[model samples]
Target: METRFLKWAEILDFLILIGSSVTLVAWIFGVPLFYHADGPVLSIFTSISLLVIVSLRLATRHFQLWPFTANLAFLMIVGGGNISSILMLLSAPAVHINPKSTLVMTSISTSIGLIFFSFYEILLYLRRTPNRFWILDDILIHLALVPGGLSLIGHIFQNPNYLSMSIDPRVGISLLEMAFMALLALSTVLSNPNLFLWKFLKSGTANQLIFVGLFVNQYIAPIIYLVLMHDDWKSGDFGPELFIFFGGVIATLGFLLFQAKLEENNSLIRSGIN
Candidate 1:
């Protein structure tokens, strides 16, 4: 019965992802969409829902893996960021806050979450397999977190404007994060090109599609941020934010996909027994 529920949950997640993608595309294409002042509140609710779904899936599937705990920790950190965003939104006046400041805060919370998750993942990965690639990935993830963490701390301290007047500190930090992501992509490609390609090809079709979807969703925002960094930072461009919104939507979908995958895999195992 649990397995059956997870399977249905996964399908629900896919539908959610599809819906989010459509909404984001519409917004990006200038569909004249307006969000409520409680946008972040809605986002937090979504994040919590995703977290619950993911937790259920993981508990049902890979509860025995040592790294599962680390993964759960990472999820919690991501959820915390979502919660923080909700708090910020609620605290601000009903009117729209300055986009630049909002962007900075959002980036800061995301960086903090990513850094914590990366460190935890690295530690868990190393415990399981002490490999050069893992070490490299760990270093890259840590390095990426540094700039954003520093910038966030600076903001908290109310640092006066610095020499780089035009460039928002968040943009610089985001660039570093993107560089790290590029390294991660390289590492994944180099470690097992066939497996990577196979995963991509299988993503939409395979039971493991949830993992693939999650992987893709996680990277999209950073990739978009990287592209936009080359442009003017102060222009209040909506491109990166749109990408981020989509990322959130994708994450929610991923939770559902994971739940479904667990049920499908379990069913196959049981069928083989028969």
Candidate 2:
């Protein structure tokens, strides 16, 4: 199942690459299709970052396409691209580079996510043995997810508050950028099926229970809670703090349920083995 899932993820990554490439081309050619008349437009930097990371990911899929040094070089290239993007955004206004351009400035979340992802990949490449190093990878992945996930939620809820966490007050994430950043993040995580959640999932014990627990906690429950509170959220009656509090509660409960289910499944597996 893990192998099949990874295969599908690769295919999805390819499609994302093609879409991002098209968007980049449109940006270069001044195509209006991807441009919004009065809304956030996808930045050239975001498009380029998407293409680089997605291509790097697909290129290194099996780790057979490149040697260790080559992979490191590519990772450096990825890091450089993001840093250059940050510099460009910061300096664009000062230099008056296409001051009337419709493209939105790249959000800090997008750049930081890519940087953390690069670090995650580098750690994977350099690890001599699994050990607790994978915990570090897990930490990086989650940290990467934090900003990108906030951008996604901000877009989903049409709230500017969630989008302005970038260093530049003017920078905001577009729907396109947020969506692909999310897909790229997920693709990055899926690239290594031997780590973290993937490892537990590949264990093939309590698949249903695990799936249900995560779905409810991560998706169904929070979504429902947010939906119930969205009107108040918009009216200033509800704030992010409350949202975070409830979300933590839900997550804790879900974790307990998931643990219990996993234990039950283990007992069954043990009995069957006997």
Candidate 3:
């Protein structure tokens, strides 16, 4: 019964993730009723994604592979992405359409969420990993703060007009963010020089395929952002930002899979010796 319940829970979580992804894609592509001003579809999708992420964290609590504190820190990073999106959506009317004091407040809250989450990811990378990629991750995480923190401060000082002048600064900061991810991808590939060879020599397993997906997404996100920043740097285009944020998700999942493979290899070696 317990196993069956767990299976059902997993299915539900998968469905929720799929639903959120679909809605987000639709919003990005300007699907009918998705990019509208009034509906709460984006908010609902973000909220459900956050809940699913939280549940995954809880389910992994007993695994004991890494420090719970580190996992919590990672979860906080994930939560930051969700909260920032919701806050931006809620505050959109105030800044662009309606301009209400309450909406300004919501925007401020969202900025804070971004700040906290960005720092949390940095802190976790520094505390948990001794790999060369760790240093790059830490620096990039800090670099991400420049635009985000400034945006928050801009909101506080100018209220509804905060996001108005934030575009150039954000674009500059995101350039650094992209560079950081590029470094991460390079470091990973260099560290595991055989990663690609292994996948090619053997039929790519599910996990290996996921790793490839992550690598591609990481690089693709930064490149796309660079292009968008060049073309639409004036209006605070969020398309690239959203892509980079999800790129971070892909990077995290890839790191987790790499760790699992390392553990599995170690276990196999130990069993052979025994």
Candidate 4:
């Protein structure tokens, strides 16, 4: 599952670029579908940032084609991050359909995360040993996920507080921004087998169990629950907390069953070895 997914990173990057580009076009032409009627507008700068970030990834993937590709990509990543930081500190708003719109804190943080990843990619291009950087890679990717994950949960629960890192409610992240950032970080991490995350997904029973549990709990089970319970949820049969509780129950039960099977297999292997 991991290998197959990672192999498509370049393709995924293109898809993301296309999606972000659509959002840009929508913003330029005042398309209602791209922005919330009652919420913050997706900043044009944000869309442009998405394009640049993904383009940098694609460029790094083929750095050998151009001798300056890595250097240029690294400079752009660092430059973008620095510019975002300056804007963040100044409390300046990014260019958007709404003139009052401010940059979401997650956008700034995501730039920083990418800067680190770009640096790592540079080292890889230089043919450095990857084993020494696994821990750093894991830390950086998880840190990158924090804001994006929070924004996603915020959207799911209809909570504005999770949508931004600022005290000002006007500053919020769009769903597209969060989605792209999360997918980019995850795909980039998985694309490199030497990363701790990829290594964990491929080996021991315990590691596999954790990966399965997280996948089910965070993704599959919630999606199933949401689809099946949409009518009830829409009619106010239960709250978000209840939805989360039941989804977690389903994930936990599935995880326990898988755990039992894994333990049985391990025991058989031990006996055979003995």
lDDT of each: 0.40, 0.62, 0.40, 0.56
In terms of lDDT, which candidate is strongest? Answer: 2
Which pairs in model 4 have colliding backbones? none
Candidate 1 residues lying further than 4 Å off, grouped into runs, are 1-110, 113-117, 126-171, 174-177, 185-244, 247-274
TM-scores for the candidates: 0.29, 0.70, 0.27, 0.61
- Mind giving the per-residue lDDT tens digits that candidate 1 earns over 1-274? 4355445545544444444344445444545123332222112223233334334333434456545555656555654654665465457523323534432233333434344444443343345323221233333433443333333322332332211112333222232233333333333233332222333345566636655565455445444564566454433233453456455544644454455455456667888953
1-274: candidate 4 lDDT, tens digit per residue: 6568667877778887887788777766766335553443455655666676676667766765755565556556655664665476457543322334433233444455455555555555566335432355555555555545445555675555545434344345667666776767766765766665555455678877776676456544544565676656542223464456445544544544455456556767888953
> Which prediction has more favorable lDDT, 1 or 2?
2
Candidate 3 steric clashes: 0
lDDT of 3 by residue, 208-237 (tens): 676567546644555455455555543334
Highest TM-score model number = 2
Candidate 1 vs candidate 2, TM-score winner: 2
Ranking by TM-score: 2, 4, 1, 3
Model 3: lDDT of residue 105: 19
lDDT of 2 by residue, 32-65 (tens): 3346543455677677767766676677765575
Off by over 4 Å in 2: 61-67, 81-99, 128-134, 164-170, 203-238, 241-274
